[model samples]
Target: MAGTSTFMEVVKAAAKQGSAACDSVAIRADQKSYSYQQLVSSAVNISRFLSSEDLNSSAGNGHLNGACVGIIAKPSAEFVAGILGTWLSGGVAVPLALSYPEAELLHVLKDSDVSIILSTEDYHELMQNVAAKSSAKCSLIPSVPVGRTEAEKAPLENFHSSHERGEEDPALIVYTSGTTGKPKGAVHTHKSISAQVRTLTDAWEYTSSDHIHVHGLFNALLAPLYAGSTVEFMTKFSVRGIWQRWCESYHEGIKADDAITVFTGVPTMYTRLIQGYEAMGTDLQAASASAARNLRLMMCGSSALPYPVMQRWEAITGHRLLERYGMTEFVMAISNPLKGERRGGTVGKPFPGVEVKILEDESGNDAPGVGELCIRSPSLFKEYWKLPEVTRESFIEGGFFKTGDAVRVDEDGYYLIMGRTSADIMKVGGYKLSALEIEAILLEANKDYGEVVCAIIVPEEEAKRKCAEELKPAITLDELCTWAKDKLAPYKLPTRLFLWDSLPRNAMGKDEVVIKAKILGSKLKQNFDIPSEQEASNP
Candidate 1:
């Protein structure tokens, strides 16, 4: 229902807006726009195309009959239509990342049992080979079609309505990969997808003029479109390109007609933007800061936003970064209030219809009141695609899904994410520390990376250059502890430190999701300890 557009009745409306239409749903980096009418036309055409491929005669006597349709395309109107078309045809849309390698692509295609791959022309060859290997048919997604004339729109609605999927029917299978595990596809029904967009729309109060950029389908693109907002696509992320767009929005204090009003990013993007801002001359910097300040909303997620970065961005832009906690399974759960206090270092309380529990009782932890965060929400995924056992184990007795991340509530009731239970949590003596909290202070690499309260730190390039110029160790353990002791607890400080050139990241043929800690931890040389006398006292 969310994706459905008023067909023939809206033809005159779309034609009035011209090529830059979606009533301005999406604008590509190159400045091409697709109207809502065009999207509906393309979706209808795609649905018809798929139905002709023997999908209409499937079991359930429905189009596709719940087959998986893998979609490979860059963020564009075509991508949106691909999803809408799959839903219209009663197929589950599996959006495959172009960044995934051949083997990884094959794995996903096979895992989801994708019956067809609707890839864009650019990826047709790649997807075709992969589809062949996976025993799946491959077809290039039709380009976003032109909207029909006023008379034509009336007939198109019924043409697509015949293949309408039920609310309870499977609509999407989003595959989420962690730093150190095989990808797991989370199945989402049409109802769940609708709920995700509605919750985001309600919480964020997305308006048509609130131009936003973020990640994930529902958060970055779908929810905004659902709220009648214009979604912009950047061909590739560029620190300079983003700042210029914000400047264009509010240049020298004049807000452009299509000024970007909302922005979202990870900590790294903000860090780079800060660095880019600092590099600017006083004149340009002032203009950039002023333009950034004009934005109605700014957000950060996908990971924790560091306090230092958050503080500096606020100093420059005058916008407090709204930090949130979410997962691929549910999109967004807890968030700092839109009009209330957005506390730093914590993701705020749950949404209106969301239920969250801190399951400290199950963890048997040394850190009191810290445990896995469990959530039950309307936007919650239906199940893991095909992994019934894993799906069942992921929930608790009360239908609350166990989020493996450890969380604790502050006195003000704000939720502070400690770290992931399997990866980010480290046990030292009688104390358990969050690696994310430590990483926020000190940074890491190589086989010498320690197993205990050890750190493999890669010094910043400037710091490395400065140390190399002086012909000394980049940073000594004494120097680090002396600097870090004021910030971290005694036992929480890294006892063993390895100064490395770089950390082993997506090296050794592993994907980007491979946990560097697991790789580093496995190859750990030894653990070192400091004397009790040298311990940094915690207040």
Candidate 2:
């Protein structure tokens, strides 16, 4: 049969190129390395195991159709194998996070309607219970054996030759982080995945020579692998582990083939890495900085990257951290360019082939200036799972996905993400204030505030004690005033401040400040005996 040439086909092709040419490392987990061929063989073996169990069969049918396989494994070679195996068996790969609670796990399994669960030994017990509750069969992903003999090896054949998959066929179903309400599954098709992989590979210039120290899960790992780059998994986010790995790559006597050249992380991860760098002794800091400087690229996203944090990071590492904006709906749409001037405060231009426009209020017209950022991209998701009305309402007149983010473009044509239009924009005395802007200023004032969330606290509450407890800012009222006095205008600044241990966030890592404000606003008015809007406006 002719070679099945696609993203998965690339893996098979790499395998046929022999142990030396395909001699590249595929995964680095627990300080050990696994090669590309091993990954392929493991995936094949996993597929065989699934076939043997007839897990893919429905009502005793021998053939496996498009069964959903729930993969509950840590980021490792096994996890990769499980995903590829599912794909090879014509099954849907559902990547489950280890961070999910049992209830959350059950919810995802139930929603995806997974037929079977393939998990690592660490998660065997947990998944067993989840599978029982969801009525899905469970199995342990067998470890790939080393040193395959001729007799043990099956004849190399094109498994995907019979089935031709289009780009729009669903390849993965990734759940949102679920910081606020219930988490929703966002589906990405083969084409979108291919587009994203190509975009990232072209943008970052990922090559076989590049060893990417991937800090996040699923998309981050798969994208690099799809681009034919080596991916080292950091299952746990450890500042020391990351810095030490970078240093080892550059250190003497340890001239390893696997040198981490690319790094991508969330805002929180970067902030922690900076803090960790600060805590190190001067000599270690110098070495760490030098090692990090040698890395080809470092990118940040998933949340707004504070300007202060970006500035500090550049000063310390000698590399300007490239900040971009994206959501789960589309893996990525806008990015700060890899070669050009990457602005610290802005998320740069639209990605290649992506079209963006800002829509104005009242008129609902495509205004040239500032308003809600709407996106039209080939990579945009099909729809929210099961939410037909939401799916219908999310698009604009031109089929552009309404981003729900308020944004503007600078003279340089860089896109600046103001914040989420609904939750991050606050109305104060007829003026609109950006909560992200205020939060950025607050981060600058005291980096120790860590995860900062700014919201409008409306006035009125029945219980004074409860109101006081819920409506206080993390920083003292005096401190907040002193901090904002110089940075913001009288109207742009937040009048009401409420602080808690942390802010409520939704699945996409967005804070639900609007909902909080509505609750707090009602309480504040009642407590202060303030007049209603009608009374206040009339009087």
The stretch of ten residues in a row with the least summed lDDT in candidate 1 is 462-471
Model 2 Cα shift for residue 452 (angstroms): 6.3
Count of backbone clashes for each model? 9, 16
lDDT of 2 by residue, 192-281 (tens): 666676776677777777788775553467667766778888877788989999898878534456778889887667778988999999
Candidate 1 residue 162 Cα shift, in angstroms, is 3.2
Assess every candidate by TM-score.
Answer: 0.85, 0.85
Candidate 2's TM-score reads 0.85
lDDT (10s digit) by residue, model 1, range 1-539: 33443222223234333434445655443477676666766777787787777653645445787888999998787888888788777688999987788988988999999888999999999888888798789998988744445633444435635565676777889887524356789998877777778788889998666777554577778777666677778666688999999999998899887788888777667877888898899999999999999999998887767676788889999999999988877879999988999999899999889998877744475556678889999889989988999899999988999988889888888998876665455556545667667765653211111111335432222111000000113566787778778888887665545443433322111112223333444454233221121111100
The candidate 2 region of ten consecutive residues with least summed lDDT is: 462-471
